[model samples]
Structure formats: structure tokens, C-alpha cells
Target: MNASPIFHRLALLAPLLCLGFVSISCTGYQLQTGRPQALTHVKKISVPLFENKTLVPRGEILATNSVVDAITNDGTYHIATLHEADAVLEGTMETITYSQVRSTRLDTLRSEEMENTVTLHWQLLDASTRKILSTGKATGSSRFAIDANQQTARQNALPDALQRAATQVVGRLTDDF
Candidate 1:
């Protein structure tokens, strides 16, 4: 069988197209697979029970557990004991505040919707020296409807706020941003 002109052109172009694709595939692209430089020394972290300065009961437990879960999910640092850790992350549930988001149409003085916020003061310290490596404050909030039981509504939304704050703390620790 005799090859047509179109077939000859296609045969020549295939190798050139492959070469072009191969050449551009690695244009300044690199696999980045490590922690940030600031946290290079801290591979394992220990989280103690946080202190609760607010009136909310069990707020400290929720905050501490949230941070631990975030760190575990992040996979950047191992959750180790105090003796095995390179750094200790200690935090305090400073304030649990609430504000009215939406007022009732009939009664402007009452709240139809409200927001619950949790503020955390945290520090990353060296396990051995106790020297402060990083310290900051993070706040997380969630909006909830004012049901018949305001206390119950507020309590139900506390974990979401705590989780958001914890994620922020872990992100700052791992990414340094």
C-alpha cells in the first residue's frame, strides 16, 4: 500500500508534538513535600488541657480536643506526649461572647438570631526550655437561631466555633502564615 501525503505529514508531526509536550511538562515545576522552615525543628507536638476563663462549662475541654483533632488531621506534626514532644501547644479559652445578629420583627429589643464567638490565646513553646516559639490569638464564631432554650442553642454551636479556632491555630503553626 502506498502512503498518502496526509499520512506522511501526520507521521512526522506526531514526534514533534510529543517532544513539545515533554519539554513543557517540567517548566519550573517542583514537588514541595515538607513543613515550613519556621517549624522545621518541631516535628511532634503535645497539647495539654486548655484553661477556660469564660463562664461556659466544659469550654476548655472542647477547645483542647478541637486543637488536638486539627493537628492530627493536618498530619504535619505527630501528637506526642509531653516527654516525647519537641513543642508544647498550650491555649486558653479567653472569652466566649455573644451578640445579636438579627432582631425579632415584633420586638426589636429581643434577638431572633445571635452569634456565639470563642476567642483563644495560644502559645507554642519548646518542650524542654519552655521558651515561647509562637504566640497569638484566634477567634471563631457561629450564628444560631434563638430557640425557646437559648442556653441549649448556644451550647450546641460551641463545638463549631471551637473547631474553627483550632484549625486556625494549627494552620498558623504548620504554615507559619
Candidate 2:
């Protein structure tokens, strides 16, 4: 019932709790493992036209749009069209592999499910420092079903697959950089 006990307990723990908070806040200053190296003057970013090394003709456009979207959406840096920006993101679509993974039957094995996998290799470079800030790969896969018509199903699945791949690639680039 005495106020003295409560005051004594608060005084005892106040310093320890303050120290813990201070340590937590200070930890943010340390560089994370894959974080981009610190820049001295660069504040803008330019993502060059991505090269689509894959046979798929649209791969380059999709990857480029994804990177630009991700970077602009984050609002962390200025997105630039000129190559003189602080950082540049470059990407290559290595492969786009498709396969029929499963066959389903509503009445008889007439419906089939197919999957498409897309793999991309990307790097973030610090333009000023000429250093590779981060390098990594990302992959995404999507599946769709075809009933009696293989071509139609494949056509329908392509957009979905490309979108998924682009999203994943963007996520990996941002998270790593």
C-alpha cells in the first residue's frame, strides 16, 4: 500500500530500460549484410533499360517496368532517366522454362495444369563509387489450367506468370539493396 515501494522499483529499472532503448535505436546505424554501400553525394537512381536475355521477347520490358515501379513506389530516392544518377539497377532475364506439372479431370483427365518458371539475375551498382552494391537472383512461377485447349491455357497463363516474376524480382532487388 505504500508509495515508497513503487517509487523504489521504478527508480531501479529506469536506467536499465533507458539503456536498452538507446542500444536498439543505435543499432540502425550499423550497415546490414546486403545493404548498399553508403553514398557520399549520389541521391538519384537510374534503372537502365533491362536486357532480356531470354527467348521471350517481352521479358526485358516486364523486368524493367518492375524495377522502376518498385523503386519509385518506395519513394526513397529520385528516379532518373539519365545514367548520371547515384545508383543504377541492371537486370537480365536468364531463362523462362515451362512445363506441364499436373493433369486434372473434372469428368476424365481432360483438364491439365501447367507451370511456367522465370529466373532473373540482377545487380545494383553505385555509379559514383563504381562498386557493386548488391548482386542476387530471383525467381517466380505460376500455374494455370487448360481444358481441352492447350494453347488457350498457355496464353492465359503467360501474363500471370510474368507479373509474378516481376513482383518477385522487384522485391528481391529492393530488399537486398
Candidate 3:
């Protein structure tokens, strides 16, 4: 009896097909996309009012509220009080600066849009271990149109800056893949 050419080819491909099927079928794992699992052991976190070194008033309060909101929205970690949390996030605003983004057509003599940039530092500490998990300093910026006054511009930028800084701090807290 002679084996056909098609039989020989099919025999070689059969092992490869079986291996593929076996590998695919043997593993029963599905990746969850909603919640990030960068920090394995930590589940709950506390965000107290941040400290601000800048002259900008209420900077600390804004930063604290935004960070807490971001962490809460992440859904990966639960927001808890210091006593109830596994870890605590601490933050400090080092400096805040503002500069002209551009001048407008109507306001030829003055800049109508301004940019506020904040330099900040933060730490993630494990309450149980009494050890720091992460620490870093970064800068965040926001551009806002002036509302005919410097105070209003500063006020508008404060929230924007805080929201961005919160994002930056959360990025520092987690280990990226």
C-alpha cells in the first residue's frame, strides 16, 4: 500500500492543528479591562487634603478633591478613610506659574488666553507596612481664556490644573505594564 502525497501533507499539518487547538482550549482566562490591577496587594486607598507650597490659595483643597475623585472613578481601588484604607496617598504642590498663551484679535494689547502650570510631588504609602510604595514630582498645565480679570483666570485654571494633577498623581501611584 502507497501513502498519497495529500496524506503526507495532512499528517504534518495535523499535529500543528492539534497543538493550536489544545493551547487555545486549555487556558480559560479572560482579561478584565475596566479595573486596573497594577498594584497587586493594594485595594483601598485614602486621599487626604494635599499640601501646597505655592502662594495660590486653596490649591491643596482642589488637588485633594480631584485626586479623590480620580481614584474613585478608577474603580480599581476603593476610597477609604485613613483608618480603613490599605494605603494612603500624600501630595504636595511645589510651584505654580502662569504665562500668556496668546494674544487675541480684539485684545491686541493684552493676552486673552493664559496657561497655568503646576509642579507637584506625591507619595503612596502602605499604612500596614509603614513603607512608601511610590514617590515622584511632575508638572501639569492648563490653558484657559481670561474672563477680563486675572483672579477669574486663576480661578478657572485652578480646577483644570487640579484635575490634571490628579491624573498625573494617579499615574504615579500605579505601576504601568
Candidate 4:
């Protein structure tokens, strides 16, 4: 009878012991909510329309929109109008290039896969002083199959490239990477 009661007490306590161990194991984990030291003072930023130096039409709109969208999604900085912003992000779409990534086995001259790359030059400036705080170049690329409609395929991949470049720019600005 004594053994039976002891076993029952241990059985009831096992779950609590297990839970305690789990909680203790997680004590080292911590939530990260702080920004990088370099950008701690910047809270709101404004992105202007990117200048398109490339030959592609409307490339500026796409690049600018992509950066704005990325900044909005990062949640590190608030998007504000030029008048209300603490900083201004200016970008120029410098180049859009396409290269053959993979050639068809049957034809060396034919491209089976192609990569689209977008290069953007950006500057972060103080809103009040118009002084450049940071400047960098970000490049983004996307690979796509060269289907029968090569133009359509290239067009579809352009946005992805722009988005990647935008993300890199934002990461550099906020994460200091």
C-alpha cells in the first residue's frame, strides 16, 4: 500500500517536473526589439521617386515603389511625407542587365535560363540639412526560364529583381549590414 501511494505521487509530480525543466531551459532565450545603434535616432523616413538612368521605361517607378514597399514592411521606420520625415532616401536605377545563366543542351547559342539584374545607387540624406548620411549601391537579381515569350518572361522577372535590391537597401539602412 505504501509503494502504491508513492508511485501515484511521483506520477502526478512528473508533469510538473518536466514543465519546470522546460521553463528553466528556455531562460536563456530573449526577445530582440532594439534597433542597430547607428539608426537609433531615425524613426521616420521618406522615399522619393527613384531616378531612372536606365533605358527601360518606367523603371524608376518600379524601383522606387519597391523600396517604399520594403521600408513599409520592415516596420523599423515609419513612412512619412517629405515635410514630416526625418530622413530622405533617394535612389537611382543605374542599370538593368540580362545574362544567360544556362544554355540549352541542344543549342549552345540558345539560352534556357536567363538572369535579370537591377543595380540601384542610393543615398540617405538628412531631411532638414540635405546632407548625405549614407550612400551605397545595391544589386538584385532574379533567374527565369526563357519561354517562347521571352519578353513576357523578362518583364515578369523585373519586379522580383527590383524587390530584392530594395530589401538589401533597407537592410543596409536599418540593420547596418
Error of 2 at 3 (Å): 21
| Model 4 TM | 0.80
Candidate 1 lDDT tens digits, 26-130 = 899876545666668899999999999998888899999999999999998999999999999999999989999999889988999999889999999999999
Q: After superposition, how far is residue 149 of candidate 1 from its true place, in Å?
A: 0.6
- Write one digit per residue (lDDT tens) for candidate 2, span 48-99: 8888887766668777776677666665556886666877778887887887
Model 4, span 134-161: residue lDDT tens: 8899999999999899988998999999
Candidate 2 weakest lDDT stretch, 10 residues: 32-41
Clashing pairs in 4: none
Stretches off by above 4 angstroms in model 3 are: 1-38, 104-109, 175-177
Regions more than 4 Å wrong, model 1: 2-29
Q: lDDT of all the models against the reference? A: 0.91, 0.69, 0.80, 0.91
Compose the digit string of candidate 3's lDDT tens values, residues 6-73.
99999999999999998898698775543335356778898888998988888888888888887876
Task: List the candidate numbers ranked by lDDT, top first.
Answer: 1, 4, 3, 2
Instruction: Tell me the deviation in Å of residue 57 in model 1.
Output: 1.1
Select the stronger candidate by TM-score from 2 and 4. Answer: 4
Candidate 2: list runs displaced more than 4 Å.
Answer: 1-43, 105-111, 147-152
